[model samples]
Target: MNFRQKNVLLILLACFPFGLIAQAQKKKSKVVTDPVFSAFSYKGNDAIYTDNPLKADEFYNPILQGCYPDPSITKKGNDYYLVNSSFSMFPGVPIFHSNDLVNWKQIGHVLDRRSQLKVDSAGISAGIYAPDIKYNPGNETFYMITTQIASGIGNMVVKTKDPLKGWSDPKKLNFDGIDPSIFFDDNGKAYITHNDAPDRGKTLYNGHRVIKIWEYDLQNDQVIPGTDKIIVDGGVDITQKPIWIEGPHLYKKNGKYYLMCAEGGTGGWHSEVIFVSDSPTGPFKPAPSNPILTQRHFPKDRKDKVDWAGHADLVEGPDGKYYGVFLGIRPNNQDRVNAGRETFMLPVDWSGEFPVFENGLIPMRPKLKVPKGTERKWEQGGYFQNGNFTFNEDFSKDTLDFRWIGVRGPREEFIAKTKDGLIIKPSERNIKSNKVTSTLFHRQQHNAFEAAFTLKYAPRSATDMAGLVCYQSERFNYVFGITRKGTEDFLVLAKTNKGETTVVASVKIDTGKPVRLQVVANHDEYRFNYSTDGTNFQNLGGTVSGDVLSTNVAGGFTGSLIGLYATTGNDIQPQ
Candidate 1:
């Protein structure tokens, strides 16, 4: 060996010792110099549940509330499984289980592992789209199909024998589309359908899209090459000019293939349409009762309004009857979509050949009569869905609740579980960054709700801060927390609208014990409150407009998220 090569090898050997110092550096980053939050709590107080109490035979409209949208369901004997689109939330599709279809319990997410959900660098609305979960009785296995718009993983599917345990890693399908679903025919054949652009090059109108179907190979877990066909082009009637005809699910009823899809875009003009075909892939005909479900035709100023209804999935209930689960929204009094699209359930009337969503064509009522033989246990409070309810998280358990979620990364990267509560090790990334931050979020479930967190922290640097965040997106949100300026600590409330952040209120604070930060929203108004003592709370920001947090102003696909946040990139200054 040359003399210079020997010297270079010796230098490399001297630094090759990955010992105690290197292990410590690998455990925690040197730049992450933020505080750890001791404990956190959240509550919901909507007046709708109190004013209109549930009768002995009545329940709520939305089976699952908050930002849970794009619902798809499948039945396995008596047990039923449901899933929803999570967008960029760390754990992708949120799954639920129900026996009678009335009282549903969350079973956790399908893509829980980071390797399966590669959205670490994706935006809040760019990660996971509509997820469809179906149980193939032919193979006795469950499949979850979705579109990961990030990481070049276009459409994918995962499988599990039992959902309560966990799910498998995703298998990438050779297709380019957004929302994909699987159908298993009675004759032991499978097909995959999704929303895609019009066939290559064609004269397209505004929002012109098509639904394509592909023969799926069960053993290979992939779409057969050259077996693709466009099933529905343009929508109900091509002459009428339909838009965004996506989220398609195929079902066979009475020896006929029924293809149902969401027509129009996902916003105000959304509607559910049905089609009939003798074969799985063929010239499908739109039902005369075409818009089986919609709320766009109703007056905008209706009472207890639930608008933006579409993107539906149907499953037969336990009682020999049909039911459909779809996504809809309840705009606030100011006609703002702050809570995002929620999961609503309605019985489907299939007395005729084709199934129709009952009460889906008319104005959506707040409550529905409980069907016969279905248990009425969901009427009780404390569960977060159906009517108004209260939910709290102590973070005492080792495993976090399914409701609390991170945006682009795993919660374990910046969290430590203790007997006291959850410990959030602050990250350099703030709430406004596209990167993953030290924040655990819960969806703002109601228009009128209260969210608070008790945190004991000390900021050693001016950039260190830890408290509560009411998040709509990275560009539109409000941060209420304790930050440091020079040598003094202050409680500050800040708002970020369309990427510009400004401090709305600030006050000096000095507390050795734990301090509580709270935010209350009454329709369009929001208030930030703080408490040094456990009992008494003082309002710092009087009443701020919630216009920025609304979809009408924010122009995003997600709802507002209330989070326990800690960050070193604290921008809001103390005044």
Candidate 2:
């Protein structure tokens, strides 16, 4: 069964235990608690520095690092705006603004409100798919279109006048496919392109997808019927039966319509192809040199090869140069996909009819020259800065940082920041639960790093618990928390793999004082430690393998996240 179908079955099974009469009368209690926020302390050695300090000409690859995938960029005058898919994380669709395209700062999220994002039933990688951002000069508004698979809100668009402030509510559209994109012609006509399932009797093989387009009627705010057409079926060569031709984007240049898309799925064979057409909906011709961008041909034994390079979007730099931003994976030890897919930037040369990446399809370089006259400036908020540094968050501010995110839509009352530290009210939804919970987490940017937190919470019962967690998903994760059993409090170390929970170790601790929990991750192994005085820590459990928490092993599209969480157990009956 599909994810939505399985979710329905799970919901039915969840309600099957209670009888009809009990279920009819049962009402869940409104658990209200102070908002729980966290302060992060980061220390790392892998800092990026430019080669030419005077000119600031060179910059590092993966410009917006760490699980930022399926990038869509649009240039508005001198400022460039970009957005990426969030996929089950709250505050979806992070919007970034940049002047030189080398340095980007996250301005805000397009879907920050609970009403805009409702992915409680969405799996780790099944919530928000590829998002496309565009700005309409005619209307003077920014538009973002994406598909929320779990919520069944197919092809929705959200707009805003000022991206720094907030975005408007989602305007659901009637589109039949995923990865929806908008293209505005110079004649003031708008078109929507997406990847749709193969038509009946047209599929010679499984996974045969087509790129379709339809004219969007902004007047009525709907896709106009009878304007639907298939621009590229399968791929450039339909006889070869290319698989998964998706992420279609239309660009108009020099009186020609350019349709760019990714082909051959999102795996190692992923690649970018281009097509040109005289009309927005027509018999487009593929570029002579197809698969213009990819790393699939790189030698597997190459030390610094990047895999899964596709789903690219183009933007013009400050110096009138074109640049491409695409998704690529930097595998860890044993070829494990731990960091998830990251955003990589490459210079685009456009002297030819069709634009091509400067480096062709080879592995992206570690360092490249930035656009001329590009200056580096450190701005506040969640903007990434290269070079060895530390990020210390005390949660003294009223708002959470852009780097911090929760699963699905966390309840507002479940999180708060106070003088004593961040307070999180225990919820019935534990880490193992697929639903939303009071768990605030940030991505694990480095393989070798330490995440330590001081959680000060007194458990009233055995059910109330709070601690630090290295979470991959509901199925695979490790939790180190302080909980009470009877009148005694203990520091607990637990692991949940494939839906089975096992308590590895538990140590009786004094509940009179606060607890400090730490998890040190070195490549593949993680060690858990705890302390009462916050000066010294004692190891509580044996080393845990980080492989089980990887995307390849855990079967998710997200990277590992280290964060603070609180749970009241699942046995709490409805009020």
Candidate 3:
């Protein structure tokens, strides 16, 4: 090696240990009881789950993480089981298991059956809506009810033998509902409650503005027809409100049933309300302290116009503490919203027969608390999706985590696992799945991070190519690849979003040799580079802004993903 090259390697290695030290020290950046707001703009930033330890723990109220909306949880012994809305994301209804209500891990999904809904090629926000997860020990089956919103339809139920696998086929309830929740009576009879969307039938006031609850007969396995009754009618409060009341979950405390739901539009900062009922079917009334949880309570986010925080589910913690989980948004910019709508948690307090909500914002820094005999693996993917799982050794699971999702519905031909690593076969498909063969990928979480993968290419023709990409949309993103021209190898960086390209270098190398590739993606920007000798590095001068993956502009049910791809070229077809 040249003297200059050797010196550069020494400097890079010498600086590596310092980076690790900084990370260790920065872990506690937010340790205050009430964190003072930092004067930083929210624009172009990634999701923030941890309170800046340096700032204090002021914003740590909501314990659960990610985009877990409309949480429904049940207590079994000391263990807490939770599930939430998966929308169009496949393997829907993520099931989470926790002991303390603070620390939770995903177990599996509930809607594993095809009868519940067809998801093979479903569009964004098309599949399952909010779902309520409940357990019936008498029948020893877990029940789930979700609305398939794409078809403008409502309510389907499924049961499972074990928490991890083998769920029964969907049993359609055939109601024009949006959110369906289940409540098990002490007498062992189960009841169903939902927001009724009345058929307008040529009237201005058509959709059901009322929340209904009724006796559900499992023997008949359907809503007890005609036994349905209105528990809470919005009356004047929800008039002209299109977002309306949805995501109803029932929790009986003392002698009252607390029907907690999300109201107002799902966007902006003006959402949320909690009500109570003396009987399962009531003259349900709003808690005197209504709108129990709202972003209005978070002084900092309120000043900037952050919108929407509702759709709550309640569960008694192992310590006999009451807690609630809901959906909330943290906007990236004041003018535009991106991938927001995250799962949040808070303590639930009861005053007399009513529930009280204080500390409107989430806890500044949240920590997970588990049971004595519990294992971490079981709680990892139980309710929704779990992201930020690290794999230093070989990947340890047969199935993927709820954290892993694709840009579009992935086909069997686009992805496979070879002996060396995961093989992503490319197709003519655009990143948006417009064509159907783009092999983009992402880990399911709201954290800013990066990942690296190794690859080997065997191109048959000059046009054949293989490489890695940071994918937000086929119309918007960047890619770095190794393409063969005749017998020559070239390093190219292409910005798909802007339609720009800049080739870094070229070398005459054997096509049969393996190439190690790496992608360093900032939650704010992306940098890609490749290594030929496995020691020297070559920088590809291209980086795409992370905002390209934002949910607002991209128009999808998920955030951006990182993946590898192989596409057709000159005339080569390896397979």
Candidate 4:
């Protein structure tokens, strides 16, 4: 009896362990099958299509649309390269290439690596500001100088032989200024110009700034000490008490050295003023017709309005015609701007010794002549003809297109491209957080447009949610997502203004099927809707205020963006 009992006990012990292993395997499989997932595919409406065909003799203003402001253009051989300021969004300093200057295409970003930039804790519109791109034909290299304001790096310069591939590591310059620019002279010497606080003393007035110059030693990769000199104090006219004499660019044309700068700040008083000097540094005289380019003189009651036109850089076109690229904003009647400052182009007419921007104060002419022999494909030339169009993203491709941008630096772990669709994991940081969040978005290219995406998401806890957002900054944004309250799930629309979040609308929903969330932007108002099925959508509740997302209310230098985001709100992992 004892031998039989011992053998039976051994069998039971081995079988009991096997039974437990089998149960654990079954639990793991359940977790894998019921994993938290969400899918989104979007397409815009193209009903209000404009039939303005691209003409060989004429082109449109805003050669590059959207939030591409503070442009710095440089020419290499027959090819021209341009870059714009990218504030807080990572992959900063988006570079574009163009042959005709009218039709342009994005080459890549200068600061593509997280090591090359530091914007993790940067506030909105605080990362990179007013980058100036230049090509040194003597050295056969390209240099880009910019200010990383939020990173507290002052002005940094990055150079490369091939800008399309990538740029070199940033060399933090020992300069105390913003909007730093580099000018290469005919003598192989390099000069850097920027705007800094006058004399570095105590505060005088709000906008008391000066344009200073320094001799930069390229071989040493630093500015020579004691070479720092104030070139223009208090802008073109010290009596006017001009402010923000920044974005300084130096050029030598027809035996005259011209120093151009953006004056009167970046608001309604913005303007471009120029001065001529015999040498790169020194007794520069302001042009009689000062403020060569500005929209300040244009009446507010004009039929068409474009304000804040300044921060200009001049480039000679392929046909030897000079053109200026500058930043301008179009504000609604409420003085709220949602599109942010965009890059605009105007013809430059030489007046004796200085350049005068044509069409001064009047609305920019929509039609202009392209350079002769300038040829472009149909798809590349008509970027601005139709103000709006449908953008369908299926996420079937292996990599995201260049139009997509991530906040701060992109966290690769938060995004996964699956065969079915894109899979995004919720980060601890949400859109409203000042810290960098895991969100990928595109610019709100149009003021009046619709954005919708279908997502299959199931939040396990009240802290987990995934959906769409129209983000302006950490302090101001709108979110529409499928959120959980206890065990129940609801589709919610919320707005965050000045760090205060308020739920605008919410509707209880079944978690059994996918949800389609849509946002329709009509001027300064936005309407949010959701649907179980793709065709029929039910409006959540009231209209969300879009003005709060504007630059006037949000107080940033960047435009709003539409994106898909997920946030866990805490460090807890999804079930």
* Alpha-carbon TM-score of each model against the true structure: 0.93, 0.89, 0.74, 0.92
Off by over 4 Å in 1: 1-39, 379-384
lDDT of 2 by residue, 14-54 (tens): 88877665765554223323324344576543312332232
lDDT of 4 at 338: 79
Candidate RMSDs in order: 6.8, 11.4, 15.3, 3.4
Clashing pairs in 1: none
lDDT of 1 by residue, 195-284 (tens): 999977874897899999999999999999999999999999999888999999999988899999999898999999999999999789
Q: Which runs in model 2 stand beyond 4 Å of their true positions?
A: 1-39, 45-55, 379-382, 570-575
Query: What lDDT does the true structure give each of the candidates?
Result: 0.87, 0.80, 0.57, 0.79
Question: For model 1, what is the C-alpha lDDT against the true structure?
Answer: 0.87
Ranking by lDDT: 1, 2, 4, 3
Could you tell me the lDDT of residue 154 within candidate 2?
80
Number of the predicted model whose TM-score against the real structure is largest: 1
- On a 0 to 100 scale, what is the lDDT of residue 394 in model 2? 86
Estimate the overall C-alpha local distance difference test score of candidate 4. 0.79
Error of 1 at 35 (Å): 4.1
Candidate 1: residue 213 Cα off by (Å): 0.8
